[model samples]
Target: MKFATAAAMLAAVLGSPVAAQNFTSAAEVRPILDMTRGSWVAIREYGGKDLVYFTHLLAWRCGLREIRYGFNGAAPNTPFKMEQCHDGAAQPNAISGDGVFVSQPGGSVKEVRVKLIYDDGTTDEARFTRDQILMR
Candidate 1:
């Protein structure tokens, strides 16, 4: 019982940063557009496993020197990769643009770490655990 309690406490401490990620909530991202909706509006899973959808263009316009991500517990070193962002004009069902960032890792992905490095010496980051990715 004591060991279990201690382990739970440690898990809570380690998971706290995930709660502080810059990921915009679904409620907060909904007001950005009156008629259009897309994955960029919030953090989400796309396609299948090892893939996550998020936004990097709303607040800072992604005006950063570099954006990188890594899988599991590895240090973030992979360059950011995302599809082009377009409005709902062309495809009413889907919207794309810089307003979103999608990472499609090549293999089984249990966790993801993303780091956004801005030119102003500031950074925004997030990590998606497997449970969070699948549950959401």
Candidate 2:
């Protein structure tokens, strides 16, 4: 079968709305690259003891290495870290992890600082408010 035919068959069985597209030039991947250049903040980390809830850092596949995040002024260091990798292919963003930032009953989350480190040794930093994060 052809590539498109196989993709259609897979999408039909899996009910996947995400479709694939081919671009002629590499510049077409810029918009996707830009979207993944930000930080994913912690939205909700409640209702569970051993689980944590965070936002999606990257939407499209990229060579993202890891995401470093922590509270604003908690301590000397934040041990929370999220790792990203691609198995001979581009990898997605952090969808699940341990307790990176635990939500409290009365804790008012002010700002979350996040850093995105790519595989090319380049990094980007961005700050996100509570409303900026999305629930998984």
Candidate 3:
């Protein structure tokens, strides 16, 4: 009887939904980073927090850059502006851009999609299932 009870209890714990929702490992996030190598992204507030959504063209690179914020979908009335930031050397870098992403609590790496608009009025958007993004 003791053995049977212990087995049942262990099985229940292992099958719980909390266990099912376990976070992704770094290996799982590698593909996302590869996909985001050079893509545009948009930053937006989700659930009272900022999240990044990927666009088609915006990409991560080092150098001079500019970006502008705009709205799409149901809420097109709001407008936002972008500022430039130098390479972490100063308040502003030549490549200043914003990104909207969804992340797990406590900085655990997770997947997110983003949309971005460039200063030249071009746009890039894409989706990532397990992409890792660092919050600002």
Candidate 4:
């Protein structure tokens, strides 16, 4: 009886999924300085002559929702590009992935790939890790 009870307790503890803390707003992301101020920038190397510039923003509502990007210094007359962003229910911009596994709420997992486009009409896709992101 003692062994059975101990085994049951162990199983219960181990089998239970870890509760993931969700961030519901863009304001919740603190690591990124001037998040509401300056744009996030990414540079990609093109066919040797062109350097592409990519800027983006992330927001969360309920789960994770907004993801938008556009050219660097797009003219006011130009329409800004945007997209619906998903973080698998984790914080808006806090989730990390390696193209194969995404860590999210309730210990849930997702497989995804992110593509970054630059103003110079260049695109690069890679397995982004958390460290690669420069929040500000």
Candidate 5:
């Protein structure tokens, strides 16, 4: 199916009005390169809970053509992963993704790096800090 048509269907499913031609480029995957150049890790540890929270940070501005992201966990990490991403055009500004990190003994997450590549050939990066991740 064509991307434009798929996007329209997605918009309908999301219950939001997505402008036509929002995603100009084809849904074709781009090449992977130096992700470290424009990316930061977003992770936080909470005591001996044996769980670490990690996520991908997106800018408030919409118009993102594509997004390429990956994760790098700190030491003592375990494999208890649950990941999700939000890149809906209907809510472009709210684009984001997050997952769980399990650590042994300490239950700490040192960091989670994220890189976002927009449709306009631009990039944005962010790392989640303890203060920002803590719930009120």
Candidate 6:
């Protein structure tokens, strides 16, 4: 208990930065992410593993420095891996794009969101509420 108390007190003294990130539209994000498009899929295992929904994209853009998944607007500096893509420069990008806030098959009680930060100091945030993946 002493250790826990000490940790808590130390944390209180050294306050952490707010995890808030700017939420933006897909069009603004796509250009920065270098992605043609992006969407939120709940439990839709791409590589396997049933976590929460993931923010997937079409034609992953290069120079994607970081991707952060935040629940209810808190961007907890979690580690994430962007999908590997090859030679995506040839593909065209979208300016006015649209996506549905799909309530995936298994619904989540809280809202979900993702932030994409590029190597050029650009950041975009997409918000969604998780739904269960429609398993086949």
lDDT tens digits, residues 1-136, model 3?
Answer: 9867644554454453322321122222223334544444534445655454433232222121332333222222223233333333432223345542333333222334333333334444444432323334
Q: What is the C-alpha lDDT of each candidate?
A: 0.46, 0.46, 0.35, 0.31, 0.38, 0.43
TM-score of each: 0.42, 0.48, 0.27, 0.29, 0.31, 0.42
- The full ranking of all candidates by lDDT, starting with the best, is 1, 2, 6, 5, 3, 4
Q: Estimate the lDDT of model 6.
A: 0.43
Cα distance off (Å), candidate 6, residue 32: 9.0
**Alpha-carbon shift of residue 44 in model 2 (angstroms):** 2.1
For the record, the alpha-carbon RMSD of candidate 6 to the native fold, in angstroms, is: 15.9
Candidate 2 lDDT over 41-122, as tens digits, reads 4466455421223334433224455556555554213434444433334333333444345554433565566655565567
Stretches of model 2 off by over 4 angstroms after superposition: 1-33, 36-39, 48-52, 58-62, 73-80, 83-106, 134-136
Candidate 6: tens digits of C-alpha lDDT, residues 51-126: 4534444223344556666555566355354444344333332222333122323333255566666656777666
Q: How big is the positional error of residue 89 in model 5, measured in Å on the Cα after superposition?
A: 9.0
Sorted by TM-score, highest first, which candidate order results? 2, 1, 6, 5, 4, 3
lDDT of 4 by residue, 1-136 (tens): 9867644553444353223234333322222213222333333323332222233333322222322332223222322234334546444443243221112332111111333333333433333222233232
* Candidate that scores best on TM-score: 2
| Local accuracy of candidate 5 as per-residue lDDT tens digits, 43-78 | 333464434332222232233344443333432223
Question: Residue 111 in model 5: shift from native, Å?
Answer: 1.1
Clashes of each: 4, 0, 34, 0, 7, 6
Query: What value does the lDDT take at residue 114 in candidate 1?
Result: 67
Off by over 4 Å in 6: 1-29, 32-41, 45-50, 53-55, 58-61, 83-109, 131-136
CA RMSD (A), model 3: 16.4
Error of 5 at 34 (Å): 22
Model 4 CA deviation exceeding 4 Å by range: 1-21, 30-39, 49-79, 91-136
Prediction 4 TM-score vs. true: 0.29
Instruction: State the number of backbone clashes in model 5.
Output: 7
